[model samples]
Target: MSMPPPNRTKSAHRSPALRPVGPNSLMADLDLPPPTNPHVQPVLDPIFDEPDDHGGPVDPVVLAAAMSNLNMLQKQRSNPHSASSSPVDSGPSSPNFQNGIPLAPPMSSGNSSSVPGTPHFGAQTELLKALDESTKVIRQNSKAPTRAPSVSGIGAVVEKPDYSEAKIVVAMVGLPARGKSYLSNKLMRYLRWLEYNVEVFNVGQLRRTKARHEQEAGKGKADHSAKFFSHSDPKANAAREQLAEESLEMLITWLKAEGGNVGIMDATNTTIERRDKIRQRVARDPNLQLLFLESVCTDPAVIAANVALKVQSGDPDYAGMSREEAERDFLSRIAQYERVYQSIEEPGISFCRIFNVGQRVFMNLIQGYLQSRIAFYLMNLHLKPRSIYLSRHGESIYNVEGKIGGDSDLSERGWQYARALPNLIKDNIGDGPLEVWTSTLQRTMQTGSFLPFEKKTWKSLDELDAGVCDGMTYEEIEEKYPEDFISRDEDKFNYRYRGGESYRDVVVRLEPVIMELERQENILIIGHQAILRCLYAYFLALPQDQLPYIKIPLHTLIKITPMAYGCDEKRYPLPIQAVDTHRPKPLRQRKNTLENTPILSAEPDELVFQSTTARDYFGHLPPLSVGTEQVQEDVSADTKLPTGGMIKTHGLGLAVEPGALKEALERGQETGELTPRAIAER
Candidate 1:
């Protein structure tokens, strides 16, 4: 089926310059067409004329229908050369406008005035007045914005509802190894990130564990194998059914205890009988709602890839076995289930059915905020093999001086790295129409300027906001506000700067970006360090505490290939040496001495050496480092470095207090550096 092109309409609430114009208005400056018949008079009147109703109520439904006809006539079929070209002029001669309803007032203009038997000119005026009133009501209702408030922007006022009591059960339905566990984990991670209570109970894992134990202990008379997957085998079917029931019992128990608002049962609930059994168990819970998510795959290549991933993952069923034997056994298991696997077709159930890894999605009776959010995220996911490449923007002017945040353009060395990016991409991804994404910042845009691929900009990909600390070096920040400096180091992920955002806040904003990335293919993301960290942590499944410390160095590219088992990672470093502008904590002012004492100079001696490797011909050289054990012995004769106790900012210098810095550090240490995440959970 083909859909007609959407009928685009100018906003009725737009500025006066773009508002709808009437024939009698000043916008009539445009030449009106000649009337089709010279004998017939053209009806010209304003959309709103004299007031006719004396505060009498008008039926909104009838008024709306009339207004719709007027809109359609003006926009679709009416011609400017016709006699009734005016939008407001629905003349009595037009049969389509007459609906056997009394639209005009009974009193004529002449009857109200001193003259009698005069024709009514106020009839059309009354109709226009009623329409004008209806327009106000329609505009008021349509003014409400439908899009959810963005997690990136601050200062937005969104009305949040209490969904704590709304519980959901998502039952998985698909053949074996159809990516059910993968989908379950992804949904769990996203919901938990949103601070919602959620959990996943995989029935296959329970069955696998049971099978492994029975085999090891030599307890069961029958072994679990392909025969156990048969629907016609009575003894084998009983064991499988028992395991499924156990998983459901656990889910129901958890929901009843309010352990979570969302619970997922991950398994191959392939038959109608199995789905009905699970539904009947949860039907008694008035507060709980059930949703079935069925994944259908017909592509043999996708299935083979998924099965290979499963074998490599070392499922307990494949324990102490050769790779070839394990692969064969898993394949046989799938073949047995395929003989009797039934697709979801229950008419009264709320479900989302996905075909061929999200190529086609059909939903029935799905609604509510949590359910809708789940459906939307699922629509973006698939099991196709692809890799995501991530890179921080090349060195910017801010980076040269160790600044935290700024939209400075790329430096001279940064430009060299940018020019070399296209060739690097060609080497890794080969020649293809790859998609490139960058932040709206100038540095990111400049870094990706040399790439020939199509480029797009995302505001959500912008660097994390440092707020007041933006464009300032860490040394300067420590010298001016020593207390804040200590607080940040103690717990970098959750310590939101004064009027600034934290790492957790960055994750919230990157949710939409991640969803879109999941839907795309071969995307190269040239973004900022903080934004990239959030994305990298999501695919890597890193802990929240370690997210802030993931080293995303400039001039290095990270590639991530997601599989059923885990994500494969690789880092390629470009052999371009740039200045290391990273700064450490400042020395305590009270001690008036640097810890691990060693004399240093403001400017060190430069090294001139010849490269001994053939790779040096292609501009590749080993990095240089300076370390000396004799520095302490020569301290008396060495030049002393500047204290940097006072930093210059906006033409003013402020010295940090040593005692205050010490107190802050001690306080953080005593608390075990509990981050904002810990605090929020508490």
Candidate 2:
């Protein structure tokens, strides 16, 4: 995710062409209503297919309808000269174009509507033409490539263009525990996960480090409470001002460094003067874009939750203190900042205010790709600590058939897992107003159906688009499109399926889901493998290369509880039969007979722990209610292997000895030190 090379054109501030039109202006004359025909719904469904668990091909009738709609839009462009001509052209140089500025033609005389009573075809066509024009304008303004390379066939793997010269400094603004730290860390992690070179310059961390150094030198303990943050207190104000200056100096230096793309300044940049100081300093760099992100929360419950989490999981100042004392100290810190806290309303400054997390969002002057991306990501975040349960939908009929992508119904074993899911959730999460989220697929919905929790679906949560190979198995893909299969194996992350999505595309679309998840409390996401992979990679902070390869097997429930340092993850396997659809590409399989493939040696119903902490699986962990005591009982009960089906961990291949595996499982259940959360928080 590198920036595009610097543009020689006028800077963003001076360029009127770069000025974005208001949303109303863009949508003013373009509103295409949905198709009223019931027949169109099925066809439209295929356009947004998920994984094999929830995707199918477009019917020919729907394809014909789409083609007809496209033809209608093309009708107005049939006469290119007419489209180029001014709508009100009485002469070659009419008043509409007197100064060479073209104006939109007047609507057909006295016709109140752009389209007549036949709204479907006419209205859609006009709207499409208008949208096309707008798209062209936007593309012209953006100097970078307007689109990815042509992926007409299933095999073309296009290289994503970079944005080389773009630099951004996202300054955090809000009172203590208003989600500033969480938002900053989350944003930084997300961007870095996208392979962007991003770093956070936390002013609080700087101030704390400085204070610690002074204390080590026998100086008095630093008062890092809210009092030190007040703008009215001269001495405290001077200390804060000095700390901010030092942090900004470091940020600017990093921005000018070789690989820095974005530097997030994390602090309570509350007052107008403080924010302006940041804006003015960064304003000197014509190439650098400064964006102020304000996390404003008023809800008492949300605030209290944030404060509690801060006391328990955040704030180094709270160390060695009791929860009561910590909470009081943190509350006092918030009160001090509230005294001088001024909401960001500086005229002409590029800023975004996120109200109570995702409840509402407002932005001004936020332009460019990087800035807009940051703003979009922030709109999806809520600072509250919560648990997100992620699981791949139960095995589909296609899994038994060895297909890659299709909207197939669940297999018998899949239904078994689905039925067992509720018990698993109950045992692990205890009680909560759990919300179920699934891709708009029948299989995922079916997998989550037995759960009494309210369910919502997201189109973006669907699996990676296999395009022309939607219903085909990996074997079929190799036979039909060997080059594409090989290309996908070579660089799976960047390999975009012909007219389908790459892992990168999946990541981009999943940004909203991630943001929404950040705001949610207790959510169980029942989605496809690829979608789950993206979500899992985000919370656990896996590298980009590992994302596409991270195996998300069926019948497993993954719980992620985000904390201050890193998240705590637990994988619980339901006691149900399911097929192993995971196809790991081994080095030996490349350009040779696909023989001697590693076999799954684990049990069909038993959980396979990765190289991650054994405690992450069996021991007591935060956010997850399950403990080693229960895990020991379950492990002892299910030690027997089921028939001949093997459960193989991919990377370990045949290296895992049966005796060693049993020994590790037994050892994991033994009593250990305090919970992983305690160790991590410490």
Candidate 3:
């Protein structure tokens, strides 16, 4: 979305004078409390808070109650959604009372209890009642005009001016082929989507077109003549500069006439001086604001590849340079361009460095960078944070089959989701480089295999272990050791599997990972459901009791950003991939007899091809056993299915429908035919 224009007039105006008070001022004495936390240093009072004749010595009892209420107010401010409402200051005129006593004065002294009699019988209670009254009076009087004379120029109240009519100019600058054009287009699209009246000016294109026309006109000039030179000569350089200046001036005039709040300048501002000239011109108008955006390639190879493709397609912008030349030019210009632009830090000009890197590395770096920038921008630019995103891998066959810890691989749909993620991330997050993190699990690995990123799988980032129940269905466990099943539910967080782990154990193990994450910049974590919940809880400041119960749905991304006081979060639910939704049956579920179904067969609709030879590549498939009934299926050739379900084919192995397997296990449980111990052993 387009930002509102800056008001240059506001910058020229002097900042309003603020009153300063000593540490022992009456206001501090009556309202401020001593800092308790070692991390919390005492802060100087804000550049406000003037003394008034209404202020006097505060009543000790009333002051105590006020201090308590202030602490409550601060806490509420920290968490805006808190249920408790802050008490208002009434200046001792409130009608409410805790008992029969009147509310204490705003500047009351001496504890009401110290008097020790009926007048102060319930001193604490009376103090609260009086404080409430005082607060209400203060609130009422705040709306009334003061009858007292103004305190001359020293106490003059300066009204804050409005800036609804300000103008903002945003400039995009980068090397020739670093995706600046793509980013500008994306921004324009966003602005249009937000219904903003925007105008885009491409200085480079204008200069090039003008130069081409000039060259055509000067073609008659002698090639060896000293009086007339080619377009690349000093004369041509002067002409281009003149054209650039004229173009910018005309563009500004048009923008002013149109009266649009947003103006975009798309140019390769290789030098700070060039950018500053634009800023200075914009600053001449009191309502104009300026923003500078810098784009850089963290991976030069990507840019070189892109440049080559663009050159092949006859892109006019890069017509002057061959692919190799363009790549070299970009590489040469990046460092100097970045340094010059970054050095020009001023109030109206905002410099954002866009790093084009692999998604995994980008996510980690971005998280950390975003954290620092959010804090910096909020304090410096007076803007709030936006766009926190989070996501997890889609469901896999391992998950549906009740497997706790095997990297079996993603069912068909899972692979489809993996391929679809890049587009989803791009569409939802705009053209900015997004950071992504994934676990080292086979399921998580396969799930994120298709994402475009520099991925590093952390061993600690793996899923919770189910131990002996790694591949067993729930019914198998219930039939075997009912007591263990019951105990697990009773203490889900603390319940350790016979040989696996507990949720609490996972939390403890994730401590280092969490610490590293905290230190990172902007990043999206592609993780498992249970593990994600713990990380989510840590950021949300949720209690330990709530950690195990946090629900993390599949195919959804979550983003969380830390603010000055707490964290802000958002979620983007990815559309389910068609393939993921309609996965073919696993080998253990089909009903065909071993002799009838070929082990290796190609199905038209499925992306997977079964090869009898390849089956050995992934290692032997686990044997299928129905309760105590052992079914020996001869594996001959590979057989493929368009959709996976409960079906068996001769020559091919059994394709176990996930539902059928669960039902069989349930029936076996009722008959006491299958036991958890037996399932674990198998």
- Model 3: per-residue Cα lDDT over 299-346, one tens digit each: 433444333333334434345665455434433343323332321222
Off by over 4 Å in 3: 1-389, 577-682
All candidates: CA RMSD (Å): 29.9, 23.8, 31.3
Top TM-score: which candidate number? 1
Weakest ten-residue segment in model 2 by summed lDDT: 613-622
Error of 3 at 566 (Å): 2.4
In order, candidate lDDTs are 0.56, 0.58, 0.43
Sliding window of 10 residues with minimal summed lDDT for model 3: 360-369
Q: Write the per-residue lDDT of candidate 1 for residues 1-682, one digit (tens) a residue.
A: 0011112233322222211221212234556674342222222221321123321112222222322333342232122211111112233443422442113211122222111111111112333333334323322322323324442222211222234566889999887756677677777767765546777888766665554444456555334556667655655565676677777877877887865788899888876667778888889787788989887765554455455555545455555777567667777787666655655544456677666666656554454445645765676676655788998888888888888888887776676677667778889888765767778787886677656665656667888888778889878888877876776765566666545667766665676577667777688899988888788777765545555655677888888876543466778889876666433323332133223211233322211111111100111112212112112332221122111321111110012232433344345335643222221111
Quote the lDDT for 283 in model 3: 79
lDDT of 2 by residue, 1-682 (tens): 2112222222222222122222221232468453342211211111212113211221222222322443353353232212111123323375633343223222233332111111211124432233233223332333223244563236554454344566888898877766777677778888876667887888766666666556666666866665665544555665666667678878888878765888888888765556667887898988887888888766654555556556655456766788667766777676566555555544456667677765656555555546655655665555455788989888889988988877877776776676678778888768766777777666786676556555555676778888888999888988987877888888777777765777877776665466456656788989998888888878876666556656677899998877654677778887777777765545543343222221122543222223232111111111322211222222221222212212111210122233443343234324321223433332
Looking at model 2, residue 75 earns an lDDT score of 52
The prediction achieving the highest lDDT against the true structure is 2
Sort by TM-score, best first: what order? 1, 2, 3
How does model 1 score by TM-score?
A: 0.59
